[model samples]
Target: MMPTPGFPPSTLNTEGTPIWITDLAAGDPNHILHVVRGIEPAEALEVLGAKQSLIQACELPDSTPDERTSLPAAALGIEPGTSAALLAGRIGEWTFVYDDSGFTYDDAATKALSADGRMAATSVYTINGDASLTYAVDGEQVQWVNIDDLVLEADLPSMPAELRAAFEAAGTIELEGFESGEADRQIAMRAACSLASLALTLSVLRRVPLLVVPLG
Candidate 1:
């Protein structure tokens, strides 16, 4: 997706959606922009007035050929299977997932993370017209955000990892296990979304190292 006037260009991934979000999270220009939850930008602006909006690319490496990981976005040298819609991101000292498509690969997302990673947040879009968001702060589900209503303003309470499995449980879905053929792409898409959601949720909660199921 193209960046707006003030927004910086970052990796935007798409499994099969029109509205694309950048990887980075940006703060308000004056740092007073209220976090927006499940609301349309126009609606938010209408109600909130002309507040500065900031968006940043998530530092997590994107394997997507369009987003650019080790090389430029235009570079054709990206590794196979890395050029997908899922990736990881960082928030303060905490590390979490920021995926576009539902499914993710643990090996790719967590390779740069520490051994004992803390759970942050994950975003998923379901076939049922649901923009589901799961937020695990300090290793627990504090809130569930719908896409339009997602406005994170609360300071994340910091804590140390008691277990080393959090990092191991993130972004490990297999997309190929889902729908096959052009006819099944829609079915596979929903399956991918579900798989992505679970993989992200588990990782942040510090649960058993889960796996993500996705297409190659």
Candidate 2:
């Protein structure tokens, strides 16, 4: 299928490499459609300065889709609700490549790119078998506004000591996923999703500039 129209053409990076996208399934029965997406594998390795051997991808159990039209608004704690946006593309094998959540080869538009000459989004993700959802995106257009000061004011329990120190040092922490019981699971999922979305956005900016719009 063709990419959703109206989104600008993804931009290419300085090296003339066209960024691509791929997605990994989160593997929950009801939320099995949750995916980690962004640029293709090869480019991801190069950008992250890591090799492919580092990535570990996994598969999910086969099952029927859910019948519910509307899941609880507080089911996952995110608003507007979610409905299997991406399907499980690859089957079997669990591999991790730079463990990036941004873009990959299985995405819709990757087919449009020809051979090694062009770039496409490549996804290396797996099913966590949990109801909680997580994702990340990278793009130059997106802005990483610092809400730490505000979040700190909320005084939501102190992050882990090590993690807390890191956040304090950076004055801001990149999106992260932490398995801190049920209470923090939702927050972690949001962090993961934010990172995934931001990374994909950045990848889009680097490769398909025309389609991406950077946040000031």
Candidate 3:
């Protein structure tokens, strides 16, 4: 579906229905997007073990592809030997952690972030065509899926009904006759993220002043 004119590029349909979790998957590969429920951006960073002292505020503008990829680090004056860089911001009730280097997909970090009545979900898509979606709650992993193959890698016995329904709708549950391609993988990822009410528009992501944290 075409994003509305003048509106930030979103997964929303013309009728304002959110069609996907995020558009990042369709853009660059080798990116990881994490959403944590009911937490401030700093708190999310803390849970990920990023030092607050190294966090810098930066404006990521919606621009050309080259600029989009290089601007964040440039704006932050990222130093040499920086092992990881993460852009963090808050949207609605969720705090989003974005890493182009795909370094934000730690299972243990997800579990830690989801502790204390919070929920954490992450979508990772690598340039090698590896993709996964994971959800955790209260310091435990509740669901994990291999998005590239549309397989349920792991799940609890009492999985959330909403999540099960989402998987079914995305055709990940019944895979005997299911045929999927890259587009289908994106759909599956979107369904998984939608369960957590996570959606980020490119415009919004660029306009927001995000916290840039560099990790060793």
Candidate 4:
């Protein structure tokens, strides 16, 4: 697929790393990316049930994704792979949170994240080739798509017209056979992320001083 205009180019940072959303999605299969509009990173973390003290004290030094994942466990002196860390950063009015270890697809959590007339969307890609995108607005799920289940439903009455159109244009609302290759699946997942206005890349992740919240 050709790069979309207005989308950030593959090299989105000074480091010149050719990072794109599809690359990240394909490389890291078991991960969740949450994009919350009109909220600070700290507020989003709090909405996800992270304690304020822990959020304040658990900012890991800026490091590679691997280091970030293991540093939290080492710092807390816990068994490796036992602690889950959430990395989040703010861009404009949206705060993006990346969870490489687990998924937060709980209804209550999604609603809470979109409370107070906010908007929240999450894109989850599992290792089993199942991918999902959930969008909530003002505490209600407005759009949802599960690739593996061939489910694509948008609350047209409540969802913004632009978003609905974006989904349609990106083929997110079209249900067909599951993508067979990892690259194809990554492209599909990246489309979902794009609909939620999440143009994340590894360079962006590295440049932004993400707040690391350790979940043990």
Per-candidate TM equals 0.27, 0.21, 0.70, 0.69
Candidate 3 per-residue lDDT over residues 123-195, each given as its tens digit = 7767686767788898899877775444343432255876665544433221233443222345435554465
- The regions of model 3 sitting more than 4 angstroms off are 1-28, 62-71, 79-82, 149-159, 165-183, 207-209
By TM-score, the best candidate is 3
Stronger candidate by TM-score (2 vs 4): 4
lDDT at residue 88 of model 2 (Cα atoms): 23
Instruction: Give the alpha-carbon lDDT of every model.
Output: 0.26, 0.25, 0.60, 0.57
Per residue, candidate 2 scores C-alpha lDDT tens digits across 1-216 of 111111223422221111222112122212212222333534333333333443223222222133222121112222222322221221112111322222332333223221233222222223342222212223211112122222543433444342233223222222235221212212222233222332233322223211110000
What is the per-residue lDDT of model 4 for residues 66-128, given as tens digits with 9 covering 90 to 100? 433443333344443565666677777778766655545565666788889998777776757
Question: Which of 1 and 3 is the better model by TM-score?
Answer: 3
Evaluate residue 96 in candidate 4 and report its C-alpha lDDT on the 0 to 100 scale: 74
Residue 1 error for model 3, in Å? 6.6
Question: After superposition on all CA atoms, how large is the RMSD of candidate 4?
Answer: 5.9
Candidate 2 vs 4: which has more lDDT: 4
Expressed as tens digits, the lDDT of each residue in 35-128 for candidate 1 is 1223232222223222223221222323344432322121223343353222223222332233322333222222212113333333444434
